[model samples]
Target: MSTTTKTNHIGRKISRIRELRGMKQETLAEVMGISQQSISHIENSETLEAEKLGKVAKALGVTKEGIENFSEENVINYFNNFNDNSFSNSQGTFNANNCTFNPLEKLMEVVEENKKLYERLLKAEQEKNIYLEKLLGK
Candidate 1:
């Protein structure tokens, strides 16, 4: 059996990382001040210049070394071994139970209350205007 080694294609790595980060090519191009065609050409290329690579790294929010060392297998392994429990260990610094309510839900409730209050205030103003109009008619 022949053992074929995988080539370290930096462009592919950048494309993959950008995709994983939920960024479109146009977005990356805008961030790098380049055109979408340029981004596409870069992704299609197997190699890139150091300066261009540095700029791409910055646009992609990764270090040059990170781009060079990126691999699908490594990313998969990282996600597979990822754990959220590290945020709260035996240390008292972090307490997950400290948040008694969902902030988003609370904000929604406040928004709804404000909307109701605004409607009530609008109705009261309309009634006052109607009363003033009736008094002036006399």
Candidate 2:
């Protein structure tokens, strides 16, 4: 199969969320008023008409766009555009030359070793502050 078809296959897999939510195929079929075989066919097929896709997305509580686009760029653009409001708070006093780590994002994780090492650095900072205060008689 073509790469586009393969991507659509991945979209089909997303339909499994209904089952993972403890919904039987028969249940979805009943709610949809369609046969279980039809639901199975839909979940197994890689391509669908726009109207059919909308029905499935509505039944699955997902946006139709979530299933239709097979392009990576399209997906990325959708997610970035979805968070357009997040970047509207750019009123801070930021000098381009003095700044680091632009393009704000979420923290992935911190390693346990890195955590312990940072604890030591924090202690060193406290000691330095104490020494500076003592020198100034504060």
Query: What are the runs in model 2 whose C-alpha is more than 4 Å off?
Result: 1-6, 69-138
Best by TM-score: 1
For model 1, residues 17-123, the per-residue Cα lDDT tens digits are 99999999999999999899999999988899999999999988899999999998888866565455334223433433466789999999999999999999999
What lDDT tens digits, residue by residue, belong to model 2 across residues 35-94? Answer: 999998888887777788777778777677755644556545545644423422236332
Cα lDDT for residue 25, model 1? Answer: 97
User: What lDDT score is found at residue 10 in candidate 2?
Assistant: 38
The lDDT, on a scale of 0 to 1, for candidate 2 is 0.67
